[model samples]
Structure formats: C-alpha cells, structure tokens
Target: MTRIRLLTVAWLVLFPLAGLADYLEVRRETAVYKEPSKKSEKLVTVDPAERSPYLLKLASGAKTKGYYQVNLPGANEKGWIYQSYVRRYKGQHPGYVAYKRTFYKHWIDEDGDCQDTRQEVLIRDADAKVAYQDEDHCKVEASAWKDPYTGKTFTNPKDLDVDHVVPLKNAHESGAWTWSAERKKQYANYLQYEKHLLAVSASENRKKADKGPDRYMPPNAAYHCEYVRIWTKIKRDWELEMTEAEGEKVQQILENCN
Candidate 1:
C-alpha cells in the first residue's frame, strides 16, 4: 500500500481531490504553526526521526498564502504547515531540514474537562482557591501568584504567563528538535518535575523568551541560584544539549549559591 504524504494546497489546485485523502505526512523536520504564516505562534514540529511520517491530516480544505490547514498529529486542533514542506506521498518523497522546532504543546486540557494546563497551573500556584471567570469554572478569573522572575506578586491571571523554564526554542536548540512530537509535548507540558512551568509576569516572560541562562536571568536576583538550579536540573534530566558558554554561566551561578 502506498501512502499519500500530503494533500497540499498546490496539489488541490492541480488535482482537486477533496475528501479523497485525509492524512498528511512529513518529509523531515518542520513546524506546524497556529496560523498560515511564519510569524504566528508555533504549535509543534513534525520530525521524521521521532515517529512515522504520517504525522498530520487535512483538517479542512482551507488554503491561504501558500499554506495548508492540517490537523496536528497528536492533537485535535488544526495548524498550518507551509505548502512547500508538503508533497503528495506517491512513495519515498525526500525533504531537507528547512526548519528547527521552536514550538511545543500549549496548555492542553488533558482530561478534556474544559480547564486547560494553564488553568491548572494557575490554580496550583495560587495561594488560595482561585476565582472563576464564569459559572462553569472553565476559566480562572483571579489567583494570587508570585512572579519569581520579577519578584512581583500578582493577583490577576491575565497578568501572568506559565513560562516554560527551558523555553521551547531553547529546548529545540538543546536537542529537543530531534524528539518525537509526543516526546516534545511531554517535555513542554510536563508537570511532575518541579518548576518546569512557573507563573511569571507576562512582561518578564516576554523578556526571557527563548533565551538561555547565558543570555537571560531573572530580574529578581534572589531567585538567581534557584533559577540556575532548575535550569541545570532540567537540562540534565532531559539530557538536553548545552553550549560550553551556557555550562560556564550555569556553573558560575551555582558556585555562588548557598
């Protein structure tokens, strides 16, 4: 049996095979974006080394500016991967590693109860019972959270972001790009490990976006040692690659810790 790798927009423009094929396959490492452009929020990357090539499906027959809407491999929602990255899977289609992953699973609703990972994190990190936005309790309206990165205490959920301690892009550069989509998702939303995701002020999180320890550190100097510890532990635990500079910086921070 032959696999139809992709039902890309270009293919549809030529063949127009609507509903004939549903699944999409990846040729190499590529990102599935939240929108049909490169600048949009990245959702995840599909890599050939991690799993089967059939990593996506046509979510709909939608097309826009050379992008095709596709269902993420391990998720229910749709994301966009560029048309050039996809091809009709006649058999043995080859592609280069045009993109390295900087995306990961967002706050997912693992139990499908409407509350997502973000809500769960907010609730857990809150010092008290969280207030809900609505009667259904689907959203957290208010919560007391201390932003370790900025040393500011916040009571509004909108003011905080559940930051990835090891930013997804940094993780990708640290060798997470080689992982399977499922593995990447697991790393992204992992909660078992302490401080993997921290509720920090949105401003600080933005300031720290995708930067490693060498480039970015918490503004709250008091949290510096703990920050380095968590960073190093995550790098060590995940077996992620580290630059010599990063290692040196981490060591410097650790030496000053009590």
Candidate 2:
C-alpha cells in the first residue's frame, strides 16, 4: 500500500496537468504570503521611493531579509493623495490652469492619486488643441514644465524629448535585453506619464543621450538632489546596471532626500 501511494505521488509530480503539484515539496516547507503568521522574516531595507509611508523614513526596528509584512494605505488616504490619483483621472482642468494663468496642478484632485489625473491631462490637451511650452521656453510645446538639468523653464513639449537619465540603450546592454516585450515597454516608457519626463532643450537632451545622470544633469544647486532621486528610482525599478559614478551620485542625492 505504501509503495502504491508513493508511485501515485510521483505521477502527480511529473505530470504537466498537475500544474504546480511538482512544487509541493517547496510549498509544504515555505510560507505563503496570504497566510498570516506572527513570525515574519523582515526585509532589511526597501527602496524608500517605492515604499509606503511616503514618510520615506526608515523603520526604527530591526531589519531582516523577508517581506515588509505591512499593509500600504490606499491611494485616497495617503500623502499627496491628489498626486497619486493623477494616473487615471479624466476630464479637463479649468481653462485658466491650461493657459498657465494658474500652474498646472501636477495631479487634478488633491488626493495624490495619479491614474485619473493622467487621463485628465491627456484628454484636456486633446480638447484644447493649444500648444504647450517648448524647450526654449517658447510657446508651442505641451507637457514641458521644469527643466531640472539646466534649472530653466520650458513650455513647448514639441521641442523636447523626454530624456532617460539613464539611457534605454544602456538598459538593453545591462539586463533589460532579457526581459519580455511588455516589461521592456514599461521600462522604456518609464517617464511617459510622470513628472520625470522633462521638456529640455533639444541640443541639451541630445548631448545627454545615454550619459549617466551625474555627467548630464544640471549644476543648479537647488535641483541636483531631486535629479539624483529620480535617476535612482528609474534604475532601481528597471534593475538596470550602474557605473561607479552613477552609483556615487545616487548616494549623494539620497543624503538630501533625508
């Protein structure tokens, strides 16, 4: 009877239709995330930019290499609530905001959500058919706001190319070459909907091409730290490789982030 039962288990292990049954051995030993446990392996450190609490503060307790074990707050209940909702919100900002009489609110609602805000910005731009600021600070570009690199301002998006502080080609050379098309697209379009995509002068952005943030970003005292944070977030999310200089610059920026 024992031998017959062992054979049955072996069959399930090798059968494709058995699906994850082959993983039973691991499943039996490892804990599942959904199952609550008083004992949780702690994660030593999580990237602050992507982590919750927007406090961006490190936990005062012990550190481990396991899951964070904390539930993040919902979009509407957190810091910069309107900022978060900008991703999908629809409809237009009042005409005055569009015309620059009032600054374009980064997120439509003040709740910190981003989804609806993205939809709203895009749709409104489509409806108005007016040109936004250009890289040269000339009228005619849309989506061009601040140029952190030069600490200059631009309104025309047409004269700008949303820069990759770390170039996409560099990403491909690193490990992104192994990623699926969907993930590649996500990494490629990293700044498509965020404030990261700045409208800078054509000559300046071209000069930056695939150069690391340290080499190309602006020297303006005020914007330098934020630039590093943005660059680090992109590379960390995409799991891209960094040169020594790039890493060093990121460290410097992190200091200011605190």
- Report the alpha-carbon TM-score of model 1 versus the true structure: 0.62
My TM-score estimates for the predictions, one after another, are 0.62, 0.44
- List pairs with backbone clashes in candidate 1: 5-89
* Model 1: worst 10 consecutive residues (lDDT sum): 10-19
Expressed as tens digits, the lDDT of each residue in 39-158 for candidate 1 is 998777666655444334566656798888875432335688887777644322242122344457677888887888888788888986789999989999987888888888999899
Best by TM-score: 1
Model 1 bad stretches (over 4 Å)? 1-103
lDDT of 1 at 257: 92
lDDT of 1 at 94: 42
- In the range 14-57, model 2's lDDT, one tens digit per residue, is 11111111111110112222212325332122222231111111
